[model samples]
Structure formats: structure tokens, C-alpha cells
Target: MTVVTSDILMDKELLHKKELANSQAALLNVLDDQKKDSEKILKKKAVDEAILASIGDGLVVVDKEGKITYVNQSFEKMLGWSSKEVLGKRIVAVVPREDEKGEEVPFNERILNKVLRGEVVVTDLTNPFYYIRKDKTRFPSSSIVTSIVLDGEIIGVVETFRDITKEKEIDKAKTEFVSLASHQLRTPLSTINWYTEMLLTGDVGKLNAEQEKYLNEVYRGNQRMVGLVNALLSVSRMDLGTFIFEPEPTDIPLLVRSVLDEQMPHIIQKGITVFPTFGTNIPLIQVDPKLLRMVVQNLLSNAIKYTPEKGKIDLSLTLTDEKKCLLFTISDTGYGIPKNQQHKIFQKLFRADNVREKDTEGTGLGLYIAKAIIDNSGGKIWFESPVSNYIEGEENVGTTFYVELPCKLLEKSK
Candidate 1:
């Protein structure tokens, strides 16, 4: 009933061997494919590492939990902390942040959290912060932090920053040089102004109508130079690291009137009306007389320059509701700043197109210096203006500049 055959057995054995061989071939193919994929991944990782290492600015990478995962060589050198030392530690562990006033930035209000929370972040050159290095030395740094997003979720964060010590030093040096040069230049400029005044008033000698007109022109030009030098010196002084502060209990309305008196010539020439208002029962406040004078002069000068002939310029100084601060506002009825260009008006050397066309003699430094003075004095400044005020000749929309100074000093620059 069961007679086994050798040929049948041989055929069965060959078929089984062939099936096993096919399975082995498929498995080998899969293994080879996996090997290629691994090689690609390693190559990409190497490339990323190379790029981060070669960058000039410091680069730091952190995992979702905010632990430092990697740091480039530049980062190690700039921060004075080795990659091995920083890795696995909190990203902020190597350095702490501070504001311009040396006040510690609260951890909850940090760029790290903002990026990790998947919020849009933008950093500007002007908004620099202080970072303390591993050596315990502090330096200013400008940084931009971004998140590594994956699947609509934040997986990690990357920060790029650079030390601005050299830049700061260079800026300081330039400021000093400007201050020195302005001082040197003022001597001769003052001599010229004094002599011109003498000649005009006949203190030295009398003159005819023609001679008086020419002398007046010369005196005006000399006065302009003196003004320019004074402005330059003020800017340099503000830029100096150790500023000389002399805050005293002062009368603000009296100070404003003095500045207005000095600008009376320009006011008369333009035939513009000047309105001055002081809050009833305004109290004497402690302030830097020189610096506040600079701010008032700048605002009033700009108001007069931008306002058309016979335009109205209103200046007001009042106490806030809390009586904690003094508010000064200068409103002009001339050419107003465009809404689009208003944001950039205070930037250094930035001039709006409309204003630049109207006045070629403008240095674009007036507002910049004005803002610097107010900021360093622990005050805030802002402006509101319509784009096009030109309805007819002698009547255009205008700009209003506002400044709020603390009654007592804040922890602003000294």
C-alpha cells in the first residue's frame, strides 16, 4: 500500500531548496536597501554638523525640553563654555540675560519660551540684550531664536547670536572722537559768532544797510554752525558709556520759555503762531536741565521747520493723572509724517521721503538724538501724524510729538 520512490523524493528535495533560496534572496535585498538608507542618514548628519561648525556666529540647539543638545565651535569660543560642558544642561545655564538697565530678565519672559511655544518671533539689531559668559564677564549680544518645527509641532529650538563687544568699543571710540572734535571746533565757531554779533550791533563798528544785510547773513550762517556743533556734542555725550548726570529740582515752564525765546527769530521769519500751555499747579520736578533743554529745542525746532508758513505750533507741558510723570507734547500744523514711515522716524540716519524732499539741510539726526536723550533720561517718546496733510498752501495736516518723563528717575542710563 505504501511503496516510496527515490525519484519522487529527489524532486521534493529540489523544490524545497529552491523555495528557501528565493526567500533568502528577498531578505538579502531588504538588508542591502537598509544599509543604503543608513549611509544617507549619516551623510546628512555629517553635512549639518559641518555647516554649524563653520558659521561665524554662535549656534545652539536645544531639545523640546530646553536642554542643550548641541553647540557649534563658534558658540563654545564666544560663550567661553565647551560643548561637552553645555550639552544636556539648560540652554540658559551657560549665560543669563539682562536688560540695558542690568535688570535680570525673568525666565518666563524669555526668547526660549517664546520659540518653544510656537509663537512668531522677530529680533532687531536695536533690541540687543546683555549675556554673561562662563567667565562671569558680561557682553552685549544680538540674537535670533527659532524653533525646529515638525508635523506642525515644535520639536526643538535653534539660536544664533554674536558677541558685540568690539562693535560697542568701536562705537564708544567714535563717540569720544566726535565729542573731542566738536569741542575743538566750538572754540573758533564761538569766536566767529561773537565777532559777527559785535559787527552787527556796531559794538566794533557801525555799518550801512547793505553792510548790515551781509553781516546778518554771515551771523545767521555762524549761528547755524554753532547749533550744529552743539547738537553733535550732545549726541556724542549721550553715546559715551559713563554719562555725566546732574539732575536737579528745576522749573520746566521757565526752561521751555527760554528755549522759545532763543528760537524767536525763526518764528518771526516764518510768521508762525506759537501756543504754549502749562498745566495749572504743575510742580517742580528733578531733571537734567541740559538734556531736557536739548529735547525741548529739538521738538520745537522740528515743529517750526516742518510747519508751513503761518502754521500753528502748539507746545504743552502737563502732569499725568497720577502726577508721577510730566508729559510734553508739540503739535504742528504743517507736513505730517506718513503712517507707513512713522515707525522708522526715530531710527538713526533715517529720513522719510516726504520730509527729505522738503528740506535738504536736515541731518536726520535731530529726532535720533532727541529720542536718545529722552530714553537715557528715563522717558518715553512717540509721535502721531497723518501721511498727507497738504490740502492747500499754508495748511497741511501735522505731526504731534509726545514725551513722558518720570517725576523721579528710573533705572535708566546714568
Candidate 2:
């Protein structure tokens, strides 16, 4: 120990000091990078705020627990609540939103909760609710809520909404105008049809061959005009929420038969084979006859129009196995819908390319009108059409439309 080298001890001390300096330098570099990251985060936040402020619709962001995390300027202006007041509060605490039934929903039952659970609610014009402002004044709002998914997990929700009172008023006025105009147009059209039919049938006097041909064309034109007028009127009523829904006891099988009879001429012309399967012991349920007739007529007419000669149509009215709903399926061996275009089948004025070329007379409003009527009656309508549904050698063999309605129309759950 007494002979230890003093020079070696001094060299060791220098090496240790150099190692400490290097460590300090690395730590300072990390601090500088962290500061730069902080600035970038602040800039990003500013950009987000600017974008959110520019939106015309009210926007709100809520965390998983439904706590209000962020809101845009329009949201503040619309609800009369600043972000500061709502940031930590549950969104339901500030809004006091009610369902269509006018009952205030609990926090867990609210649509916000549903969104967090991965249910997308997109612009429910049919089932909207009242949103109370900070001043306790309420207004009708149409809203859409979507989940904020991150890494395949629903972490929060974002809701966007707009006040629809003005829009509703405009729709009502438009509906009235359409109703009035349709009624006015129908009277003259009916007179024209009556006279044309009289000329054709010799009710007034016998007509020459050429005269009868011209009169027949006029009669057909008038009939088409009448159908357009009626469709317009029905669309107007649906838009205005003014459909007179008087539920009367109905015989569904009898109603179906009458509609099929109306299409018999077309069926015979096309050489289509039809099979009817009525459920045994079918019960009579109260439903709006005119509205349901429109549905059946639309489906049957479409089947007859699209199917080729020697095709088959299978019509059924059955009680679902659960016995809780009525299932009406109309399956037709026609040109099946294109896979890419099936989604647009129910849209207003939409026609598929394949069918449009074959039958140019379609107004494209049949399915749209039928969907609206069924939805109003608290039912569902959908279709399955694929090339695979046809025979092995056949392409675009057929399509099937299913209308499932509850035995008793249940009140809307909004």
C-alpha cells in the first residue's frame, strides 16, 4: 500500500472527469430536443383550434367517460357554453338532451355513450331530439356522432350537429306547395284521361282506326302523368311528416292478391311463372292499407318489368319463426343488380345501368317511396341480388326483396 503509484491515481481522476462531462452533454442534448418537441406540439394545437373554429356546424369532442374534452367556437355559440365551463364536466351534464319521446336520457343511455361503444349515428332526421342551451331554451337539432377510433380502439367520440328549425320550416312550405300543385294538376289530367278513354271505348262515338290509335297514346300519356303526380304528392307528405297513418284491420293476403292481379297482364306478356305461399293461420294486423299497397305494387311491378320470359317469381307472406314480425319476400328471377351499384338502389331517382337499358320507363322513385313508407311504419326493407343467385349458366339471374314489419308497429326508439 505504501508503494502505490501517485501518478496513476491522478490519471484515473482525469478519466473519471471526462466521462462525467460526456454524460452531461448527452443530457443537455435531450433537453434541447424536448423543448423543440414542446414548440411543435403547441403549433399543432393552434392549427387544430383554427380548423375547429372555422366549422359552420357545432362540434364537440368527448372522452371515453363522456366528459367534455374539447368544443369548437360554433359549439360554444350554439349551446351558449364556453369550453372552460364544460371541459371537465360530463357532456350530458351541460346539454340536458332529450330523446324523441321528450324524456331526458341518463348519461349511460345517451347517444354519446352509444358512440363511445362504436355505434355511428349519422344525421337522424327521422328521429331527432331537443338540445337545451345554457339559457335553458331548447331547440330541435339533427346530430351525427362517430367514434374516435385509435389503434382499433374507440377512445372517444366526436359529434357534429346543426339547428334544423329553419330547414324544417322550409320543408313544410315546400311540401304544401307540392301538395297544392299536385292536386291542381290531377284534376285536368283526370279530365283528359276520361275523354281519351271515352273516345277509345266508343262511349261518346265510334272512332276510326287512326283516331283510336292517337287517342290510346293520349290516354297512356295521361296515366303516366297521373302516376308522377301521385308520387310527388306522396313524397311531399313524407317530407312534411304529414302522412295520415290510420291503422285499420287489414287482410294482407287479400291485399297482396289484388296487387298481383293488377300486374297479371304484364306477367302474362312476359310468360313469368309465379308461386304464392301464404302462411297458414296468418293473423290480421292493423296497418295503413294505402301505404302498404304502394310497397307491394312497387315490388311486384319491378319484378314483372325486369324478369325475362320464362322467369320465375316467388312471393311469400310468412310469420317469422319467432312469430313477432311479418316477413314478405318477393324473389324474382330477373337481371340481378350489379354488385357495385346495389348500394344506390334505394336512393331517389337512382337507376341501375343494366335495368335502365332494358326498361327506360322507370321513374327510379319506386324503391325510394317504398323505403320511406316502410320506415314510417316502423319496418325494414332490404334486398339480396347477386349473379350467384341464378342458375350455373345464367348471369344476373335474379333479385329478392324482403320487407320485414313488426306484427304491431312499435313506437320509435330515438
Candidate 3:
């Protein structure tokens, strides 16, 4: 019964052969699929590399330790360094950055380093810095940095920069033109102002009420024009690095009081309640009195001009808890700056939509000039608007501007 049979053996052999053939076909299919996938991945990688290399702006990639990992063709051309030479080198050291005054930026303060340390950095084109090339020459560069995050961890950073020499030259030319034009217009403005004043005061001849009123209007308009020209001159000087600082030991509290006294007439006109708080033990700060006064006048003017009748304004002068710095604050219950437009508040000639709609007299240069003065004085200027209160229809739909300056005398920039 268990005897071997030819037909049975033949059938078993055929079945084994069939299975072996099927196994080989399946293995070939798997190899084919892997080959296609590898080809696709290689093609995609090449495309990505080509795209990065073809970018017009200089681009570089650095690892977590800040070593150069990759650089595109534009980087090589703009920086005068080859990709082979820069790979594995420190990016900040390879390309040193300089401030407007030509001082080297500190290592820790580099934007790439800040990004590596997990800080969110934002830079604008207006704040251009210089980047050194391999030949030791530098060019004005505007750059943007972004951290390379993978799986919730920052593994690297990417920086792209462009040369802005033409832009810088254009800006300088524009400022020079403004300076020349403003100087030329001053004589005519002065003549107009003097004659109008004479007419109003009856130095030439007695005028009727209507004539006097018309002359007064002309005088006010001319005065506004003169103020604008002065503001423009100030901006041009600041931009051209010709603004001089004359620091003195100034009684800050007394200065603040004088500003308030000058503004009291306008305050009374508006029926605005003023709460002036002069903190005790505040020390006199050594600063440029004229520049500081201009800053105060701009802030207080905006507060009084923007606040509605019967609104509240708070003016405070105090020393920080450390007593090392002086803090000047002016807050008004006026129209708050729109949230979306707050970032551009200090930009030149940039008026917020809300303010422009409510008040048309703003030259949009006050905050710009104020910021420049404070920055040159080695102080900080910033503002905060209670937008929520404005949105909720509270009485304090307003903004608070703060200026903090060190108590000691700061060396004037050359």
C-alpha cells in the first residue's frame, strides 16, 4: 500500500518546479519596483539642488553647530568664496557683518546665532548691514534667516542675502536732494511768514477784521509749512550722519514740567484731564537737552492732538527700579493705533489708516523723528495701544509711548 508510484512522484516534482518559478518572478518584480523608486528619489533631489543653485540671491545652509553645510552658486559669486572652501567652515566667521557705523556685529548677536539659540528674528530691508567678502571688501547686504526645523527640533538655519549697493546710493541721493531743496525753500518761507505777520499786526496798514482773519490763516499755513521743512531737515541730517549731540546735565523733571506748561493751553482747549506724576528721588539725566525736548514735544503733541475733548491723559516721569535709567511715559485716551498697522508706526511718512481718517493734520514724521533722536541718544522708544479697550468701546481707546534713557552721559557718536 505504501509503495512508490511513478505518476505520484511526477506530480510532486511538477508542483515543486511551479512554485520555484513563481518565487523567481516575484523577486524580480520587487527589484524592479525598488529601482524605480530609487530613480524617482534621485531625480527629485537633483531638481531641488538645481533650484537652490539657480537662485539669484546668495543662499547658505548651516548645521546646528553653525558650520557651513551647503552654499549655492550665488553665494560663491557674491561672497567670492567657493563652495568647496566654505563647506564645514563657520558661517559668521567666514562672512563678517558690520553695522551702519562699520562696527563688527558681536558673535552672539548674529541673526543666525540667535536663530540657532531658538530666537525668532525678523529683519527689514530698511535696516541694511554690510557683509564682508573673501577679498576683505564689503557690500551692503539685506538678508533673511530662517531656522531649519525637523520634528519639532531645530537642526540648522538657512540664510539668503542680496547686495543693496544701488539702493543705498539711491537713498543717499534722495536725502541729499531733500536737504538742498529744504534749504532753498527756507528763505521764501521766512519772507512769507514775516510779511504775513506784519500785515496781521498792522505794521504796514490797518486791516479790517476779514483781512486780519485771512492774513492769520496765511500765517498759520505758512507756519505749518515751516514746521514740515524743519522736520525734513532734521531727518536729512540724521540720515546723512551730520546730526550733532550736545549733552548736558539736564533736570529731567523740570524739563517735563516746562513741556507740560507749554502744552497746557492746548490741554485746556481740549478739556482733557491731565494727571502729572513726578516720581520722588528721580535723578537728573545727562542728555542732549534740545533733542530730548523735541522728543517730549512730539509725544505730548500727539497725545493732546489725538485725544477727544474731556478725555484723560497721564504723564509720568520716574526712574526704573534699578535707578539706572529714566522712564518717561505719556498715555492718552485717544484713537488707538490699529493692530495691523502698529509695526509701521515709526516708519518715515507712514500714517496709520485710523489716524489719517480721524485727523488729517499729521505730518507722519513726528514719531519717526522722535525715534531717531531717542536712538541716537542711546535710549529706547516704544509704544503700546490698548486695542482691546478700543474694540470694547472703553474710554481708554488710546496708546502709551515710553522712552527710557540711561542716567549717565553717553558718548556721542561721531
User: Which candidate should be chosen as best, given lDDT against the real structure?
Assistant: 3
Question: Which model is ahead, 1 or 2, in terms of lDDT?
Answer: 2
Per-residue lDDT, model 2, residue 333, is 88
Clashing pairs in 3: none
Residue 247 shift from truth in candidate 2, angstroms: 2.6
* Top candidate by TM-score: 3
Clashing pairs in 1: 389-397
State model 2's lDDT: 0.85
Backbone N/Cα/C clashes per model:
1, 0, 0
Rate residue 397 of model 1 by lDDT.
Answer: 81
Please report, in order, the local distance difference test score of every candidate based on alpha carbons: 0.83, 0.85, 0.88
Q: If the candidates were sorted by their lDDT against the true structure, best first, what order would they fall in? A: 3, 2, 1
Off by over 4 Å in 2: 1-26, 88-115, 118-146, 338-346, 387-395, 408-414
As for TM-score, the candidate ahead, 1 or 2, is 2
